[model samples]
Target: MTSTRTRLTPEQRRGQLLDLGVRLLATRPLDELSIDVLAEEAGISRGLLYHYFGNKHAFHEAVVRHAADDLIAQTAPPASGPPLERLLTSVTAYVDYVIANREGYLSLVRAAAGGNDRLREIYEEARAVLTDRVFREDPEGHILLDTPAARLLVRGWSALTEELVLTWADDPAGVTREELLDLIAGSLPAVAALAR
Candidate 1:
């Protein structure tokens, strides 16, 4: 049978492949998302995949970077709203993002912890962006984060939120989504206040 696949521009094809990688990542670790599998799914030869990404590691990095960017974009705070309301909005989006991308998020965390310097850097950069958002959106956060100790406390709070959200995603433990959001969003000031 003659192939009837539509031709895509180089950039379009590369983007299409990356999108597929991101979707597949939703269920498997980056390490297990082999080039062969991606090629088969894309209906392209492995050589063509390498032609686009140069190598497996490069492809993995591209997929991870896309995922991180998507997560950050999805969780961005509203440009204008009541401070507390904005925080809760972002937190709600974040919780929803992680729950929907649970396996992908977990795999990203595992990749960072697996001693890959580049992946770790990508993960840390995403965390830093999120931490900075908390400070930027919280009306009192600027004053609270004036000192080095205060900033550290906020970062710690970010970690706490991450752990709680991940745990809650796995098992709610009788906590309602609203309760979890309120707990995470409401605890920031108290956590940041420890620096005072």
Candidate 2:
């Protein structure tokens, strides 16, 4: 009997490793992820993993970056819709995503708070991307995040949304998903208005 494997380009192989890392991350904390374990999971050697990511910290950074990007991509708002409708749709998608990836989401948050500077940078960058999208997609000219104060308030709203969704996912506390979504989606304008 002969064993054979399909050959993949370096890019494809790296992407495959990152995808695997993200999947594993969904179920475990980042600190628990080891290069040796990941290499074994991929049927590769640890040296090969090093070739792709350089070192353990680099590998973790790459994995976190991929996860953050995936989260942002997953919750992207529809390209066409009423402004409020799009906001609600985006918020719904975000909530659904966090709920589905609850453990992974928590791990990411913990990793950031655990004093890993690179992970913290990746996490903050992800939040900034989401915040900028909200401003860029404001078709109604309502969320005028023009001034620094306005932008600060909108960022605060983003933080609130994240905290609310994470807490609400653990226990709804009698708040239906729809109501939670409404509160998150509807409050942005008011939150932004505070800077007026």
Candidate 3:
């Protein structure tokens, strides 16, 4: 096996393209995206775009991976504490991320639901990472006894949170972000108490 040297600073170029793709994700749905459109936006040719990613599916996969990796890194479980508190910290970080990067992340979620199969697969992997973290932070929560139970819990909680976030994004005036976080965190204690 021979290791080929990158000819045109491929690392930097790939970063630029991913960044470009992420921006496009926010503005336009992923299904409608084309390598030509991405190339025009980045002021690069389709050949150059192909060099970085073989197709739109590959490009979107990279974008989801990049975003998910960053989110996972940033929202890592808190150091040493009541699992509940650590869980809350992780959750708060999630809400904050949604508030700050609403368009980009939500688009990734939407794309995963019904976009390129490659990208959808990558996005599901990312979602699992996040859902797993939620479970980790709540090890003693009701879902611990079974994997399917845990998945169900995650789905319910995440759907509610997602709706709350969409509402927040739509009208920041009506609901306080802090209040939402409190309500979510409160559920943990309630659930944990019953489990005990």
Candidate 4:
């Protein structure tokens, strides 16, 4: 049997490579991904992967960036709603995303904690974007709401949420999803208290 590969535009080709990288990263650690294997899977040569990304590190960064952007977009709440309602919606979406993308989530977390500085930066960037989105349109518009202390509190809460998701991913049966959502949602008051 014979197979044929379709020609793709530069942008389409790059996206295809990144999508493949994300899929592979989900099931395997970054270091385990290889140009040869990825190329073979994509029906291209190893040299072609480098042609698109320049090198492995660049490819990894691109994949990480794409994942971060996607996660942010996927979890963003509706533009208008009660703060608490919006928070719950966003948090639930986050939990669902983490559960659905366990390997991808774990790979990113492991990379960040395992001393991969670029991955860590990407992780931090994602957290910041989440924080900004959550606070960007607070209806209250109180002077203290967007203060530096408040911003830090949001960042800290986001870190805590990450840990919670990681733990929940390890043992879904240990805590019901409702309980997981409540735990993260319940922490908002404490976060607010700190900001005040």
Candidate 5:
């Protein structure tokens, strides 16, 4: 690959690399990402790429971490809102993000299910962060989700939401976004009741 040097500082260059990796994840599953291709896309040498990231696994880990941070930041709800409204806001943001970045979101799911331990950890961490945020504001303490039962319910709901969002993204004819949202929102009480 041809290399054209840029004047970006080390940290800026690393951030640029991470950004490119994120874009690449949008089109390819994590396991399929090619280091050579990444280096080429960045217009940098493989040696230079390794200088920034020790190896492909390191690169993947950085990308996963970056994606998780973005996912959480983009979907964060207003802290002052009513509990249900905040949850709806968060869920809506999540569904919107998945719809807008289907390939990337699916890549995360595929990585988690494909036995990539690091990716699985990052994915679960992201999910747990969101689940905790959404349930922490429960007015009736129905969805506080601190107990084992509540935690399990939240995890199940998260899985269900991911499946529904992916399915709807793949083929809207099966279910509209609003319908999917309704189903997700409707399940909250039942899930919360499991805690009680």
Candidate 6:
């Protein structure tokens, strides 16, 4: 079997691996993203897969980090305003990014939820930042009960965002961005009052 030890340019190899990993998630569940299949598809042998990622879980962790960086980079809001304003900007930015990376993000979601506890832990940690931002923006908002609550809510929102975006991914006509944002925004009042 082909491995990903050094099949292409390093960046290309990495891209190929990540592409394989993320795309595999769509056809199969995250836990089902076999390293053998991944190596085969990427034109690398299983050994290279190991050489590149150490193992499937390590590869997954790398994917998670890459995806999170993309998210954090894409959604980082203006830092000179109320937390809520910053949050709104960040969320909208995030929605746009999610719309852009639905497949990859959803893949990670499935993998994180259906695979390792470590994966789940990492996802929750990233998710908590969003909750913290939300709470900071609109203190005592409806969300923010605990880390789990934040993960659940953020994941819920992400799932919704993915589903809606996926449905509209190729279509020209669908829920406008404003409408989607409004739906998310509408829940703010309750979230703001969550712990009250």
Predicted structure 2, TM vs. truth? 0.91
lDDT computed for candidate 3 = 0.71
lDDT of each: 0.86, 0.87, 0.71, 0.82, 0.82, 0.65
TM-score of each: 0.89, 0.91, 0.74, 0.88, 0.86, 0.62
Residues 1-196 of candidate 5: C-alpha lDDT, one tens digit per residue: 9999868899999999988988888777776776798899988899998999999899888888888888999899887766777777888999998877677788888778887898899998999898888556655633455777878888888889888888878788867778888888778877787678
User: How well does model 1 score by local distance difference test?
Assistant: 0.86
List residue ranges in candidate 2 displaced over 4 A: 1-5, 138-141
lDDT by residue for model 3 (25-142), tens: 6566556568888888989799988888887668767777777776777778766677667777887888877766667777677766774676677776766777676555444543
**Lowest lDDT block of 10, candidate 3:** 137-146
Q: How would you encode candidate 2's per-residue C-alpha lDDT over 78-149 as one tens digit per residue?
A: 887776777888889899888877777888888878888889989999988887776775446445656788
Give the Cα error of residue 177 in candidate 2, in Å: 1.6
C-alpha positional error of residue 114 in candidate 5 after TM-score superposition, expressed in Å: 2.4
**Looking at candidate 3, what is the lDDT of residue 52?**
83
Q: What is the lDDT of residue 74 in candidate 1?
A: 94
Q: Which candidate is the best by TM-score?
A: 2
* Superior by TM-score: candidate 2 or candidate 4: 2
Q: Over the stretch 134-159, how does candidate 6's per-residue lDDT look in tens digits?
A: 54433444244445555556556655
Clashes of 5: 0
Instruction: Give me the candidate number with maximum lDDT.
Output: 2
Where is model 6 more than 4 Å wrong at Cα?
A: 1-49, 137-174
Indicate whether candidate 3 or candidate 4 has the larger lDDT: 4
Candidate 6 at residue 42, lDDT? 75
